[model samples]
Target: MTVQSKQGAYHTGTYRNLLLEFGYSEEEIQRRVLDNWTQIFEGGEDTRIYYESEDGLGYLEDTGNHDARTEGMSYGMMMAVQMDRQDVFDRIWGWSKKYMYMTEGENAGYFAWSCQLNGTRNANGPAPDGEEYYALALFFASHRWGDRTEEPYNYSEQARKLLHDCVHKGENNDGPPMWEPTNKLIKFVPALDFTDPSYHLPHFYELFAEWANPEDRAFWKEAAAASRAYLPTTCHPETGLAPEYSFYDGSPNHFHGFGHFFSDSYRVAANLGLEAHWYGLSDDLVQIADNIQKFFEDKDPEDYRRYTIAGEPFEEQCLHPVGLIATNAMASLAVPDSPRARAAVELFWNTPVRTGDRRYYDNCLYMFSILALSGNYRIWMPKN
Candidate 1:
């Protein structure tokens, strides 16, 4: 397999289980990870988000919205592949391909961002975040379980085709590309002009550069570098809080008043944490993680609120306080050597996966944090 020059987990094949590092037994860590999965995927109806149809397909419901979304489906696929649950991965993929994949439209190659439980389209548009995760998760599935000869089960081909469409969509005057070609930056949606800071996943793009179609490899490589360079500019100098949406120039986009730190912004820390764990965390990333952890060190999750990048709080309380906690703890991966990192981990360990109305998003982040901090989340390489 080809390897990057950087000393990342993909090259070294080594991962740190922070819970074990901090004196948790290996058995406990493994059990905790499994328990969280069971709770999310198979527990009581109150806790479980995954539902399987009699036809052998499955979908993750956004409990709050009461619909299936590409974001949750792709995330469930990624989580399944990471945990070696091929059954779950295939079911989710099948459901997604059957229900969400749009054909003969402006978004012909893309999946509808949202769909009803009965597989009805909620909107005809696509979300770039979902497309990115879908491509990456499919790649992981191909490497982990091998591709099939059938349509949706041809995992590697599915991934490559998705990536190809993401970059080349506008060439034929069909739909706009998910990323801005000139800057190599991902837009919030295929048709939008602004970007979500949390969508900048450089680590995933690095792998795409190596595994994507040869003609698109250079573009993926440039996209990876561009995201890495763009991230630091999105965060505040002191607070390190990033806006949910920003412009290509890294300034917060005031469009729809999304320039504040809120629900989507929480993923920025979690993304940086995973990227730092996979690739080497740079000093700037370390500082960014440090700033975020320090900023919330004394704050209670119950009081979490919408805030400006400068750390000013709004009257609005956070919709996903549990998610904020999980992501903040995940940020510890970037600052593993700091006492603050240990503190964050301790806090996360004490928390439980959320349930009820808004549990889907929060619990997904919680499960990811569990996998990542325990080093269970890994890069699946080609077997041959």
Candidate 2:
């Protein structure tokens, strides 16, 4: 039997606490959320992924590479907001603005995607994925904790201005826009023509339409619609695996050897799940999530491998099995009652957060799955 839709008739700021519904006691839910958060953000010695520098800047390092990425920094900030850790959120935001924000160039208003521990820019370019996450996290921060008078601390204004630049960057002929102007789909980067399937977060765009500058609200609304329509085309009909990068028409664009279902493609399931939970905009998403879970249902997590969209495995082993499992469990938010969904969640519950050098990405996805499954990853509304 297919999973039943939980799409309520209207949007509520809150969602069903799935953990409770799944037979987890309140104490169990609270402990799991806090324990996971502590392990990720403040665990003793062997477990924590976040750290503070001598200069008081807090950053999340991709320990495997010995570098900081906007992806991790912004993701850390988002996690901080969702968990109500304002101090941690402020610390991460301060580090991002101090080190990652670009000031006078074609990419001004955008952040440098990578940096060093000493706050040095590793590259002068921006990544659209990080910028979008940064904007959404800032918006949530403004609603949850209110804004401040300082530069980067003016959360709502910072988010609004960033969204403005995302769609209007090339109007003065300085740099290309982060999104393609005509179709309103986000680019892999401002200079590219293809899209990252995981980068199309229509739920975030729906909120942007409501919170961004009035002049750009229409564009964001159109973007939400465009992305909702775009995702189904990009995913495989039978397997539901998406490429890391694809053209606007949903064909894989293999420019950088990212045409397969690899590291970046894992988030597509999670994104689609959240979109369904938040806005109830697409029923097709449930089928997509089902197809993905069913394809891997019987495979051992340790043997998970990289594959083409049609489900052909390659010699390359899966880089982050914990992360893949986490996202697969997260897809349960969209397809709650499927046997595969239950199996995925059980697997996640049994797996601990990854430790050691390559833990950053896996742990981040792990924490996100924890939040989403507990129904704590919410839309914080502004206090009037």
Output the number of the lDDT-best candidate.
Answer: 1
As for model 1, its CA RMSD to the true structure in angstroms is 2.4
TM-score, cand. 2 vs. native: 0.96
lDDT of 1 by residue, 112-181 (tens): 9999998999998998889999999999999988999999999999999999999999998998999999
Candidate 1 runs further than 4 Å off: 1-7
Which residue pairs in candidate 2 have backbone atoms (N, alpha carbon, C) closer than 3 angstroms, thus clashing? none
lDDT tens per residue, model 2, 211-286? 9999999999999889878988999999999999999999988877889899999999898767767766465767
Best by TM-score: 1
lDDT of 1: 0.91
Error of 1 at 346 (Å): 0.6
The estimated TM-scores of all candidates read 0.97, 0.96
Task: Give the alpha-carbon lDDT of every model.
Answer: 0.91, 0.88
